[model samples]
Target: MKPSKHTKNQENSRRNFIKHAAVAAAGFMIVPRHVLGGKGYLAPSDRLQVAGIGVGGKGQSDIASFAKTGKADIAFLCDVDDRRAANSIRNFPRAKYYKDYREMLDKEHRHIDAVSVSTPDHNHAVQTMAAMQLGKHVYVQKPLTHDIYEARKLTEAAQRYKVVTQMGNQGASGDGVRQLQEWLDDGQIGKVETVYCWTDRPLWPQGISWPEPAAQIPKELDWNLWLGTARDLRYVEKLVPFNWRGWWEFGTGALGDMGCHLVEPPFRILDLQYPKDVQCSVGSVYVDEFKRGYFPESCPPSSHVVMTYAKTKKTKGDLTLHWMDGGIKPERPAELEANERFGDNGVLFIGTRGKMICDVYGSNPRLLPTSRTAQARTKKTIERVPGGAEGHYGQWVEGCLAGYGKMKMSSPFEIAGPLTETLLIANLAIRGFDIREARADGKGYSYPGRDLKMIWDSQNIRVTNFEAANQYIKREYRQGWTLGV
Candidate 1:
């Protein structure tokens, strides 16, 4: 006799349950939410699995901050220098360690939900791109990339891969920037027309020739891997750990080191994008009374770069940004008392009606005249990040768990990419200042790049007038390295 439809349905359901139960009894485990949803998924109860590349110094602090969130597990640590990584190893004894990021990514990509890259400038692009390609959320140190081209590519990749990304400019998440924003929104400062960002960085060294002698490679460090995308070169004393900041090969100089911290407040407050034109003058070192020291390999001791941006929603007209480094600073605002300290590292916004100033990381924002800070009362329109600057790591971790596009990030790649590009473009003009060509008479070199206002075609990412300056927009990687775009 034919079975009733409901009875048949019940029988089918029982058969399916028995099949699944049998499979379970045979030692097959149920797939986890992460496994079923792919690498991007994280069950609410599960902690984010994080892999840290260049896990030393800032990288060490970055992972520690993430772990502080109590919602992340520092599962892996990769650093070329074991000595540099030793502290992190002790901090996260359970975290597996590797000398090469590529190897770590290869074997453990499935286990890692996110990656933090705190390596030197040159390696930033390749390491970041590799992780983003594998579906890992990334928190990269600023300036986001060593070159302008890398910044653009990583920005596009972050969107294409649909991964949450935050640049490690913790200042972007600070409450101080929000206060400045609120003040601007309330017309307390009026429309900002000019900005000055300055830093006294390069305390390591700059405007010098590369050390001639190769130093003994540290026993615990893998020198070859440390070089990464940088041109194969002999290791020199002090270049490791920190002095690399002054060199063109591995670092982005003072502007790169502190620009993100100082320039970021103005960049965010004004809604500025790429610059239409940039020109710079760099302080020079003299070999003697007659000859100037020409160390093209090193960043200048000081530079003043002027970048002009077309009008934005936050501005009444075109905006001018001045970036000063190597202890240089803009002239003190007339409103600021002579005795009032203009911070060594600070940002000054000169609006039509008034001026606002803030120290590095956009901290201690106040009106130009110290007395006005107390009188100004602006509504808090922008929500402050929990724990302010310190919350940066946790913010990214939470965003990753929430899935892409679910949460808003303070320094997401969308904002950071252009901010980074802006600083690098200033570097381009500073580098261009040293460009020299063989004289037609063959007596000496002609410095044509000097005193030139580089007209930037932002769409093409090139300096239209100076063909020589264009070479720096994107550098050729060492033979084996690729951005993997």
Candidate 2:
């Protein structure tokens, strides 16, 4: 049957929309509009206006969480890849879209009250500093910055700009952390002296050479723009849409990935700050029969970094923190039954009297010995965040509307900044493990710097004993990519 031209065009439009929607949903979640908002719901002007940069994967979920708060207007979405950004575009159809965040900020900064940054570790500092410079509230994902310098600067900028800042480690606002603090306050775990945090991460590749032959860049992704603060390079397969965590340029490895979530409880309860000294051992990857690959461009497959912190008001003396990543775990405590779980990702606190443990995101906190978790319940001295973990988004939303420092936050920069530095310091120790230099005789490489404990002068921001380790404290940006702090 011959159809009218209008009908044929309408059919084409429907098919095109469906095809485009499906592609966006290919690697991302395509949430229904009803899930984001219902009818008769006009987002209020008083509601905080948020523009998301790098809106995909965790970024996508982050903006959605903010929207679900009913107090945030997701007014703008930005991403380097259209395919990765498709779902967010669909969820926030009314919001404007852009490929570069700088352009969005240039044009829509006036409209945006706050910005949420969920980009890679490398871009975090530049994007965050830019937003702060614009006097916009910011909700940045955890391990605040790729370098120690950036973390310190962002922490300072938040104060100077008088803008509310929240790190995306929502556990900072969770009941788990509050509960840990309460347990500490009640003296259940008296004067914690030793701590252990572990995670099974790098579910991505690490300790490998850069791909020799570059793969064709995806049509959906702007490879150059995606490189943001990283060095110029040909598009490599599997580096995008995820797996960048294994690379030193775009990601901070497992410690940066999970440390913020697992380490915050101990940091909060024990009032821990920058470590005084750090040392680490990393698992070596063997390329063949007799050769071990020390791919300078990649992080280790596994690492065990140990950091020593000076006594704080909450501690008895010098406390030791152990961070295990890349599937390495600490020896199981005798208190836990072999049959029971110690959690795939968790933190353990050892004190004068007892021990406590918690899972990732600081959830399911408990005193060791399954029975003690219930038996030794402390009074709820610390107030709980309403709605618990999910409240993190709302807490930031309310705080943004209330002005900087008006309302308490779960992971404010003041708190998160120092916490992030803690992990980066641990990372410095990890990076130090593989440091190499040509032998004085010029025969071969001599890893003289290896196995040395880095002495950190937090005030000066340098590794006093090992000059080579200080490089990680503040990485030089690639050409044309300034941190802008």
Candidate 3:
């Protein structure tokens, strides 16, 4: 073996070359081809270019993070609300502005490498799918789509297109969230038998007393465009700008608005699949004849939902997930008797061995059974996930720059699409409270406690209850504005 120094050097060189080649294949190139004194990894020269669609409210904040980096350019800004999106449009002078995203994609497909989609829950799927069809990567916001049909389609589209993607649940990228995942993976929380997640949303305006008959639309808002992809309805002042979180037509209630944040930790850490049984109860806050009295359209004053998820063939067993909104709390776990209840919202994981408490969106996590557990004598190394960038937008920007899709995505469509579908079903249940209880099935879940079950073929986006509630699943787009996903 020591006969020739040349032979030894040749073997070492071969190993080094393999290592560098692996790095390059994963979309990274080691600096200094010599491989002896490289400082940092660099992305390939095809720096990605992106467009910002629906740059209003959250979009404004989200778009800037990606635009700051030279890796991508904010080539387009699209929004139905002119006033809300004006600042973003002005900020990105290079981007072409359009009220309709469909037109923007058609005109700018060649120049765009990806899109940042931060529209309302209802329009997410249509806009995202359209962009994907053109072979563009997408960074869509949480609660990926309005309905189950749309969510499933988005997952398929992303897989088919093989484009880089990241979902807008920035919390998923946080160090705290990664810690939660590690804790679960290490069985810190034994078999997670139950999970309770809640939030104090509608802080923007939720739990509004049901509204009266449709009111006149405000002049500042584009009522028709605002209702894009939604059924025709006279615009009301209460629903536009920021109050849509509560309404069945446009929003997902608190669950849709916050579930992706509050429940996601458990889903990821616990590897949860669809629930086998789902049931919900809403408080008596109705003020109008049509279940429509307050000015703003939102959800009931309060609601509690219980979902039972059966363990997959590979998982341990059955698990129960509970969601509460409007300052509600499930029966506290016996161990945390003195621990303060989740004031506005938080998630609790109850495992066979021990439980973990993670703040909503996985901000701060602490172990339960503190008294019984011993502190480690030596400092333990914690594995950090790559997605935690500062805010959600910043992470997406970094991902865009991460050529060859090397970045770790927190809410990739694969993980987010199903979660969105589960939350959207809760909305469907609210609208069809009177008809029939649908059961969770292979094609899609159904509402239980009803006389007839709504058979949903999610692959086809059709429903057995077409005569009954299909109208609720898919909305009619207003004239002059049509979106295809």
Compare the candidates by TM-score and give the number of the best one.
1
lDDT (Cα atoms) of all candidates against the true structure: 0.92, 0.89, 0.70
Error of 3 at 125 (Å): 1.4
Worst 10 residues of 3 by lDDT: 371-380
RMSD value for candidate 2: 14.0
Choose 1 or 2, whichever is better by TM-score: 1
TM-scores, all models, native as reference? 0.93, 0.90, 0.77
Q: Candidate 1: list runs displaced more than 4 Å.
A: 1-45
Model 1, residue pairs in steric clash: none
Residue 218 in candidate 1, Cα distance off native in Å: 1.3
Q: Name the better of 1 and 2 by lDDT.
A: 1
Superposed Cα RMSD, model 1: 4.0
Candidate 3 whole-model C-alpha lDDT, 0 to 1: 0.70
Q: Give the distance in Å from residue 319's predicted Cα in candidate 1 to where it truly belongs.
A: 0.8
Residues 1-485, candidate 2: write the lDDT tens digits.
89999999999999999999899887468554444567644446567899999899999999999999877899999999999899999999999999999899999998999999999899999999999999999999987999999999999999999999899998888888888888888998888889999999879999999987889998889888889888887788899977898899888999999999898888888888899998888888988898888897898999999899999877779999999988899989999997989878999999998998999888998887879888985788888888888899999999998998799998999999999998998888888777888888999798755678789999998899988888888877778888675
Give lDDT tens digits, candidate 1, residues 1-485.
99999999999999999999998876656567778879766564578999999888999999999998878999999999999999999999999999999999999999999999999999999999999999999999988999999999999999999999999999999999999999999998888899988988879888999897888998998989989888999999989899999999989999999999988998888888899999999988878999878999999999999999999978879999999888888998899888889889999998988999999999999996889999987888899999999988889999998899999999999999999999999999999999998999999999998888999998999999999988988989988899987
How many residue pairs collide in each prediction? 0, 0, 19
